[model samples]
Target: MRWTKYWWLVMAVMLISTFAVFAVHDEAKGPEKFGRYEFKEQDKKAATDECDAGGKPGPEFVPTVRDKEPNLALLKDAKPEASSQLEGWCPRRHCVEYLNDGFYNNCRSWIIGAIPGWAQIDIGDVANVNRIYFGSDHSQGFLDRTTADFDILVATSKADPNSDANTWTKVYTHKGDPISETTEFTFKDVEARWLRLHIRTNGGARVDEIEIYGGKDPMDVEPSGKATTTWGEIKTE
Candidate 1:
């Protein structure tokens, strides 16, 4: 009887341990409703207020133009081109006229511009986007401040090359400091063909690069159970 009881206790302990491990994994993996684009809390509040006040969300609030333009201009004076270098990935870069003054061994660079100036890229076909990465060359430059003042937009139609103006659905806006390089946003059930990085003001700094990733078919991977501490790491799961 003693031997049987010990054996049962050992088995129970093992089962409990396994259950705990799985629980932790599931918690860390996060939620399944991860968004492709998300707005800052403050921005969300403002948007909500505007919406409640009978104001439309997105470009409706973005100023039509700026009083002054940034000294920097587009490098090629051409729009971004789609690249499939990363396999099922399309990446592009839009440079401001200004470059970093060789910070981070030239790793840190930026393009300064005014509000309403933006970089728009096609994600190819209407797909659900879930992740984004944004970085600046120099976090202290004039354009860095613009990140917070800007709003990211997405569109469901192919861009018209002949038209100077393109229409996109505004997704979210930044509310944190301008110097942050690695920022992430989450959007739920958003489908679009193009993504636009729209700045409300230059914040007197330049943007080094903005990356959009994650539109793959949903996977059944187990959750990691680790929670994100920063607002930038917003995950849908």
Candidate 2:
């Protein structure tokens, strides 16, 4: 009878401990929404009221790239396209053109409409790349629209302008919490003129910036958008 009592006591303690851990985690994440505007934590704040009013970016709203290396995805000639974007709701604020603009304001991010949509960048030339960065709006607030599960893909050439099909190779796959801040993914050097952020699952996903980095001269090729380029962008209306 005494042994049975001790077993029950141990089970009760384990259950209580598990619930306590989950409670702490939920508290750290904070609330998800604030007066219809999604809530995102930056520098560990409960909420940023300026973002609710559509205010300008603050001093902490710096570019995600902290190093001297140029963001190849931000080349002047680089072109971006997406499968679908949130239209009519916010006018030109949520267009795919803002995907690689090297900015982080809430108004400058792309809100993709499709759950499995893709945002692609053509660097305008074949470049050797090994690293990529993805981020949501740190200036305003991040919604559940921030990508949850996605893949980073690269292609040397494309058979169709509107279709990814079988032309691309996956470099990295992320399947966890939604990306609400700048995150980096690195792999072995791969040569390509096209880089794509493929979203698998999300809640009206938002993509603020996607930065591709290739170090040195031989590894990084400055794009010219010459006739020799393999892929042509599908114009987004």
Question: TM-score winner among the candidates?
Answer: 2
Off by over 4 Å in 2: 1-53, 56-66, 89-92, 159-164, 218-237
- The TM-score of candidate 1 is 0.42
Winner by lDDT: 2
lDDT of 1 at 193: 53
Displacement of residue 74 (Cα, Å) in model 1 is: 20
Per residue, candidate 1 scores C-alpha lDDT tens digits across 1-237 of: 999999999999998975653222111111212333221111323322322211111101111111221101111121343211112111112223112111110122234443345655554445454445554422221222335565556655556422234545555666555544335565543555566665555444345444454333322123322222123333211
- By summed lDDT, the worst window of 10 consecutive residues in model 2 runs over 228-237
Report the Cα lDDT for residue 181, model 1. 37
